[model samples]
Target: MTARSSSAHVAEVEGVRVDTRHWIGGRRVASDATFTDVSPIDEQSIADVHAGGQAEVDAAVTAAREAFGTWAAMPVKQRADILRAVADGVDARRDDLAMVETRDNGSLLRSHLRGVMPRVAMNFRYFADLAEQISHPIDEIRGHRQRVSYDPAGVVAVITPWNAPLMLATWRIGPALAAGNTVVLKPPEWAPLTASLLADIANDAGLPAGVFNVVQGSGARAGAPLTRHPGINRLSFTGSVPTAGVIAEAAAKNIVPLSFELGGKSALLVLDDADLDLAVTLAVEQFDNAGQVCLGAFRVLVHESLHDEFLQRVLASASALVQGDPRDEATDVSALVSRPHFERVRGFVERALADGARAVLGGGPNDDLGGLYFRPTILVDARPGSEILTEEVFGPVLTVQTFATEEEGIALANDTRFGLAATLVTGDPERAERVSARLNAGTVWVNCFFVRDLGAPFGGNGKSGIGREGGAWSFDFYCDVKNTVFAPHGWHAVEGGGDS
Candidate 1:
């Protein structure tokens, strides 16, 4: 690694060059205190990243505040054009971004290249077009006409998680920038490099200085200050419930508006009429990304008639998942993000096993593969409302429970505190609609897992999240909606300049 004062600090990792510095006011800012970023694949040091503190947060927030007026005042079409250009930049460097994220976060390279990377570009493009096309109709009440408009909220602070760094960050950033709000993003410390790369892309796409700034470091140092800063007009965060609580407190201090997508213990209900193959596949999908996903179906409730068959098929599919090097194209799964995270996940399963839950498939680490790789685990016989059954383990461990009746199934699925997402595998359309409406989840999928459309509102119902984000909903959060009322035809203003 080499530090250049006038430019970004550059480092070479596995034949790829990456910028590792805080991006503020269209400049790369470095600090004397740095943290070593390690790759989860082999536990090797990848790069030295600048550890941001109050000073960096102050600089980023100040930049965003200064840029907010001009950015917000600019024509929406012009802003959309810039967003489209950023999308193009992301598309042009898709392969590189995928590779970097894979190494940084230990997610499969194939997933990033095929799914995550493309969706990242799509987020910008989708928001750009929506920003231009979305319109609010004028309303008439009594003798007055009112035109509702959304004005950009000044300085938005976007704090994202490491599970799906680039994609999730852009999910918030695209809409924020499209709404004409300048943003100061505090990327997760575990997978911060891709965010730096994104800043570079934004700058190259001609995003004006101070419009999009990044401050990279630990939550206590960078995130806390950014959340609590008075300059921040709006905030969005995606992480654990405990972390969200901390952020909620910080936001409350300044009364900064916040949108959160927090933890989930989402359930996948296997109805008696469901296709056994499809139900099995959906159950196995929970192990994708090593079960780090907040929307993952960690709790599986199966109808008694299909329980035996579903369990058998799910085990076979999970066992077939290839766990190895994340860089390999054929690899389906990889190591957890870090040693601490691995330990945390491992501890969850250990405690469950001790509590008498039966692990028919996997119970602990996959020693044969070694190094932070945990086997896809399936637990059963856990008592109702037990720790493993109710809490979010956030690992490759899933528990299977049986429900004898339709009412029982719905009750079991809605039992968790989290309502981020749920999946119902059923062939009957009427039953799908009936059961889906009753399930307490923000998103309900019928015979599908993780199918998302940018136009639809996305969020949680309970502890899963605070507010929705997507399409106009995103605009609503990033902007202050105001209605301008007009005097009816032939109406006259008062002599004091007040409307009659």
Candidate 2:
């Protein structure tokens, strides 16, 4: 229940000791086995978390299943009020939560406090208001009066990734709760601190026991069981594609619906008519979280006319970014989540160089700052078909490629298997509209990058993901739609009663 200030360099959170346990039903629960949580910033032990396996998953799912009816049956106004309180609770403890997340995931404290923390509360508020405004519409068809209603999808297994842990978790949890489904969240072991804190906040907000639960551990030990559990009616996962496939297979066994927000090798197309300054600004912004974001512009497809100019601008921006301790407010790029991930990202750059791609700026790790730090790299002259251009390198690396014509640019943008998100920078509104339609991505940004509206749908197409997760789309995903038909009493079927 405690965290260090943003200025502290050590991983120690004051009151949170070793043996941090799971939050099941309404209270803390422990397991025999435990795993150590190491800080990405310093590679120091943060805490020893109870490693919840199938036994813990069973307890959490059972609790959620038991609580579903009561939570679903609660008055809409009451649910809205509870959600509002949860939002307020997050706002009240914003600094602490942000510090915990910074320690857990090595994200910049400035970004966490200024960008992420506010969105955490905003997400809850959005769903809270939506709960009150939601309505069931009626329709008349073929002489039958039909009313369509939405019901909770029962117990939902919310599995979140390490990067942007709480924000992404809330993306599913908020809508799922607002839709009246009980949630058993399984946060990534690497970054479970903030999520655990969130559960505590929800409890303080008077969220009933068993209505929300949190199980902490790795994917195989905790996530697999949660996904395979037959008691779970739906699964919402935001992580890598391979892990998502495993979850999808397990959910399929139980015929449970799933919403997968998987990885992305998204493209940012800089058209010939683009504003060079704005394009470069957006490109740097895409790499804000050290390029750990799912919607990051991994592949930069610039029109041949502006390719050289764009590369020059981007290189300057990437090189000027400060890389140091995440605790420091001035640090622009922090460490990767772990040493393994650091090596993986380093390997991507090395392999690209070995395969004949040239480095425009940084080419490898930054041992100067210590910890799992990688210099923000820009790989140029990368072939379109190469792994560097096609795969999801979740790091501060940008691959630049050129296209001759508009047709070629669009084609190159959609060349990859991932269709999560794409950005187009152009001055012409007509060209923006025309190219956006052909991009083949779930969300397309025009003239800007990462511009999001909570009311709009947010998800991917193709291998990027399966379903949407925002606004009405999120509510629909977490709820089951049922059609009720009403028949008139003593109604004889008159000839042509319904004007077919």
Candidate 3:
């Protein structure tokens, strides 16, 4: 594989050169073992990342545990102010972070600049304010006043995925920090650079020592120790289901509460009355980020009457997508995050074709743009129970399924074991409401896709994994709720426990 120039591989954020070592106790901590971090764009060695093991995990957890009490006890206003500062820091270094993330994960640079980078700041700002404003009403019943309060759940272990690392990490980290729990984050080894940069941003924003830490390494060496560590009070993970099951088993032994946002094989349902243009746009949009998104509508279920037109439009749009370097402003698609992922996605298409599926658009790699650039694929006539149709490929591939009736369409959309999100297209308001309700998904987008509000609940169901995290839902998972019951002022206790 070709490699990018050495000069281009070096990254700097906020005039401070990016460091690949683990960040513990507000300083860079190096592990004895190390691994070469590679970029997917040209499969080039970007940096030497410290491959943290059990010792590093223990140190990070200890730092977080030591910092927890002071952080949790701090006034909400003070914490909120610190978070607001962190948000500002992120915004100031937006360009650097966006570029680094693009290099590390092969996502379009424009995407990071326009949508993702800005959202990372918003996650912190929104959660900071929300945490400060959190309130629970008190009730007086049977001469007793009852009130509930939220307390930080000690040290939280946050494990984030690579596709949208910083944004998703803050999605959980913002709330965890706002709610006063210190965090030990294990960023995906494939894209760990930006996370290392984020630690600097947090420290510069006046976050106390040991409040936020990063452990860099692969799943087995760093992730396993962090997730299973007894010092961790809460475990939050966003990744594959198989990994979640392993983390869950580890969490169970220590009785640590878990918040998981796992994999999905979500469906996009287009009714006969739907606007064909809008439906096609949404379907093709799934190819964004090279279809590495968990909420992507990979299984597109179209009404039989409009399936042909929808597929034709999708092919036209997908064919026009530019597959090249993600750093290029005009590039619409880029390489898969790694070589293994590239082969895995290619295998899905190859097996589907061999199983009698017909490729409507693309079915293999784009040789001209080689390295790991796979052409956007659209497969039809796929075997019903084939892995290509049922599994989470996490690639730029879509399988078209036709249904004759609205009932059938809904049935097909809900057929998956994963139900993270669903997209419903219909001209009728009533139909959108009814059909969306019937779709077995945690979040149902009507007409529009990827429209996210930080306040809205976001997560998955079934094999998509468990828990909702956004707004109050995030605090609910990161904090432990405590209810207190006491007698009202000057009130006499009733032996019968009934109001007089």
lDDT of 3 by residue, 51-74 (tens): 999999999999998998899999
Off by over 4 Å in 2: 1-19, 489-500
Model 1 off-target regions past 4 Å?
Answer: 1-8, 494-500
lDDT of candidate model 2 versus the reference: 0.87
**Every candidate's lDDT:** 0.89, 0.87, 0.90
Candidate 2 per-residue C-alpha lDDT over 1-500 given as tens digits, one digit per residue, 9 for 90 to 100? 23533322123463432226789999889889888788888788777778899999999999999999999999988998999999999999988888888888989888888889899998889998998898898888775777988898899999998899999999888889998999999999888888878988999999999999999999999999999999999899998899888888889999999898888999989999999999898888866778899999878888998987788888887778899888898898988998889989999999999999999887888869766888888888876588998889999998888999999999999998999999999999999899999999999988877878889998899899998888888888899988887776578764345445
What is the alpha-carbon lDDT for the whole of candidate 3? 0.90
lDDT of 1 by residue, 26-135 (tens): 99998878887887888777788999999999999999999988998999999999999999999999988988888888999899988999999999999999999978
Model 1 TM-score on a 0 to 1 scale: 0.96
Query: Weakest 10 consecutive residues, lDDT, candidate 1?
Result: 1-10
* TM per prediction: 0.96, 0.95, 0.96
- Candidate 2: which pairs clash? none
